[model samples]
Target: MSTTVWIILAGALVTYLTRIGGDLVLSRFERIHPRVEAALNAVPAAVLTTLVAPVATTGGVAEAASLVVAGVMYLRGGGLMTGFVAGAVVLVALRNLVG
Candidate 1:
């Protein structure tokens, strides 16, 4: 309906296509090169950094604190889901209290 909606839909479509394309291409290969496998393994962390770094840089204290909490949680072996939930709780609590 709106430009933002169209952009979101387009992004979703592209993301889906890229995921399926990657799977298809990898399936055709009998064995992946060690370098290629290492690069693929690094993709998730790279993507996460790209997504978080911009927001953490430009956001307010609440956002920054949430990111710090999440990072610490992960570093302390809290696991992904626990880190995410902890960050989300901090974000919501700070936003509500500060605002």
Candidate 2:
């Protein structure tokens, strides 16, 4: 097989194993510790926050401003979708204005 084909096969195998491994492990385990369960449940939120923190904190002027606007929208009872849309709009508008 070509290099690209090998790489694609490897990626597919990895993905399949990851999905199957989670199911197999969870099915085998009758009970998990409360702390472990809590940590597992919090993993998604922690990952998302980690991914967004840098963009929200250490970006250019436009990004920083948009982060602030998004944060305010979130604080004012706006949902995740609303905050994301507001931030995107702010970023795009500011980029255009600056350019």
Candidate 3:
């Protein structure tokens, strides 16, 4: 097989194993410990931060502006859906204005 095909197969194998391993590990714990449960709950915020931090810092004006707006909305007690909608609207308006 070609090197590219081998690489793709390896990646797919690794991805599949990752998903299966996560399920197995979680299933082994019948009752999660408090600290572990809290950490697991924080995973969403951590993932979101990882995903958005780069865009907020180095993205285009519209992206950065929208991230800031969304953050403000979230801090100001807006729910996730509200923050997302407000940020999307800001991004769309900025994109239209700039383009």
Judging by lDDT against the true structure, name the best candidate: 1
Query: Sort by TM-score, best first: what order?
Result: 2, 1, 3
Worst 10 residues of 1 by lDDT: 48-57
- Backbone clash count, each prediction separately: 0, 0, 0
Which candidate model has the greater lDDT, 1 or 3? 1
Q: Mind giving the per-residue lDDT tens digits that candidate 2 earns over 33-52?
A: 89979988998999889998
The model with the greatest TM-score is 2
lDDT of 3 by residue, 1-99 (tens): 999999999999999999799778989988999999899899888988898787678779899889889989989998999989999999999999995
How are the candidates ranked when ordered by lDDT, highest leading? Answer: 1, 3, 2
Q: Which tens-of-lDDT digit does each residue in 61-81 have in candidate 1?
A: 889999999989989998999
Give candidates' CA RMSD values in order. Answer: 3.7, 1.9, 2.9
Q: How many backbone clashes does candidate 1 have?
A: 0
lDDT of 3: 0.90
For all candidates in order, the CA lDDT equals 0.93, 0.89, 0.90
